[model samples]
Target: MSKAKPLSDAQPTQRKGAPLPTDPGQTGYGAPPPAPLPGAPSTPLTGTRQRGGARPVGWNSPSSRRPPQFTDTTPAAPVRRLPQPVLVSAAVVGVVALIGAAILGYRAMDTFDTVANPLANPSAKQTEVPLAPPRPTVTVTATPVPDAVRVKQNGLYKAGKVAAVNCTAPAVKPSTEAAALRFYQAILPCLNRAWAPLVRKAGYEFRPPKVVLWAKGQTSCTGEPTDVAFYCGDAETITMRGDQDSKLFRQDATSGRIHAMDTLAHEYGHHVQMLTNILISSSSRKGWAKTEPAKLEESRRLELQASCLGAAFLGANKTALGITGQRLETWEWQTKHSGDEYNPKKVRDHGSRKNNWLWSGASFKTTNPASCNTFTAPAAKVS
Candidate 1:
């Protein structure tokens, strides 16, 4: 027709619901074109025509083909990628923060322990860490000494009326070591009788101290040579160098008996300190002192109190021991001489000669232990 159009130039008739041919060279009219085979090259589009009136948006014309529509129900595989350097830096920062937090927590706990138990180990080595100042030790009920003894160091306690002592003096003077030993042994019974009731009245535990008259030996308490008379609270023993003490007593003609009696009484005063817990309290104070000067002052208080107690005992039984006015004067003089003035370096620990005389004289005029509270006395009085 119309001179019969050539087949190559003929227009193809389309069927309903059939896909249109995309290539000019393709022959399909009604059926869909064959799908691309696996690994086969894609056929190029030769026309701008689609089933619609115009090409769809995002579709290129002619040689460029529209991408195949995917109808697969399975999800695509996620792309695998290395983490960014910035993200890696963030992870490293998080780990460092955790480590720093742990170290700070540990240090905070250690500081708390040190502050809570200041007395647990005071000699511990110091560190650069900032810490709170040490606080004063609280007086607890668990302490070895009685509350009265701890608080009354500066006051008086009425030890009650001491009865007259029934003691007969030994005939032999302390001229020889053996004679001195016998003389001290004889005097022990009188001392026990004089001090026992007073200690009992004060509601304290009491036992007669053991006496050791050694010529040349070391004491168990200090492991030091027994060159002078001393009372050891650790052993509850009174040790006297019999050879040396005998010579000391005999050297002074005017007050040989007074010197010997005072020496023995002074050592016995230490026994009273141990019984009443004075020694325990004093040792704690001295050990806790933060300065050398404070420590020395504590020592002076202890020694001066002991001297006062010794005079208390002597005054309570002065008539029984036949201590006349001249003997008393000699005793006072000897007490003054026994002060720290004899040794320049030891002055701070034993008080001045005037302080020793005042304390001893005060006790000699009173029967009350309350007057012997040297701890509460003014610094000038102690000095």
Candidate 2:
């Protein structure tokens, strides 16, 4: 059988600072137009007069009446000029009146909306509404519902793209078992909604994995529940040990809510693996997983993929889930603590903190699962 090739190594850098964690055999990883200026009321041409005409400063009262065709001895009446003090006062009054008229004209101009006034620009044509440019006519060529053969070869990559989800982040207070259980249960539907449709489209029978919210004392496919959280591929169940989980998933932000999401979603990521047959296919692979380095490599790919898938969901639904950039940045930085380096025995079962975040950052930047194809990436990148 053809195993997935090592994918491209185009991962982004993990931002430093808030949330990552551990679990037994499984359950691990976590990771928002300028109006055009209308022609200025043509600046109302300074010299041009407006309508409401009183006729241009008429010189001819009755047309050519002219000074009665004469020059005039009437100059005697005109020679009686006003007294100097009165003339001065009248001059001052005229000045004040001119200033008042200027002020009023300015005020009227200030309130006038030249664009709205049609007469403002008689040359202007009707705007014609531009018909919205026909919305660019989206000729959606459906990606041909990838066949089973395509799904087998491409795996999750065949699922194509997804839009961000409308998932409300459940208010969770860590260290409280009930809240932890509720938190896990709350996001299950969202996780289901994210992966189910894609599975069905892939020509695979889709069944959501079981989620045991308070399975601290319960049994999982792995037998006794020793881990804080795990996904039992054998039974298709996602079981959580609430009490121990509260203590372990103790990420302080949102009362440790984000930390819980990372852990739960990481496990859910495993569920995606099972649904896509990647986990099953991995188990049956030869030489690659048999050697120690190869084993860790495979493990990292798997775990990191979980990180990516889980983050993809969170990223998709971040707005509705109240996940802020600050929160995610903090989470990326803290992911370093979850690396195999932190393990007491120094076993690299999960992956390097950098790789954990590398995959996560890649997937979080988009709602697409195909980007999480760590199986096709080079070993150095995953390391």
**Best by the TM-score measure:** 1
How far residue 55's Cα lies from its native spot in candidate 1, in Å, is 99
lDDT of 2 by residue, 1-383 (tens): 00111111111000784444333443433210123245444243443444442232222221111111122223323346789999999999999999999999999999988778869844556687754555566787876433323323654676766455577767655567877778778888888887888777755778887766644355555465343466778888776656644654464444256666766777887887787777766554423446787776766777777778878887788888777877766556555445655554466667777787678878877778888877778888778
Task: Identify the leading candidate in terms of lDDT.
Answer: 1
Q: Which pairs clash inside model 1?
A: 1-4, 154-376, 156-370, 157-370
Against the true structure, what is each candidate's TM-score?
A: 0.58, 0.56
List, residue by residue over 56-164, the lDDT tens digit for candidate 1.
3221224333344333345545678667997899889999999999999998777766556788745467789979899999987865555435746421256664455
- Estimate the lDDT of model 2: 0.63
In candidate 1, where is summed lDDT lowest over 10 consecutive residues?
A: 5-14
Give the local distance difference test score of model 1.
Answer: 0.66
At residue 229, candidate 2 shows an lDDT of 60
| Stretches > 4 Å off in candidate 2 | 1-152, 172-175, 213-225, 248-255, 286-289
RMSD of each candidate relative to the true structure: 36.5, 30.8
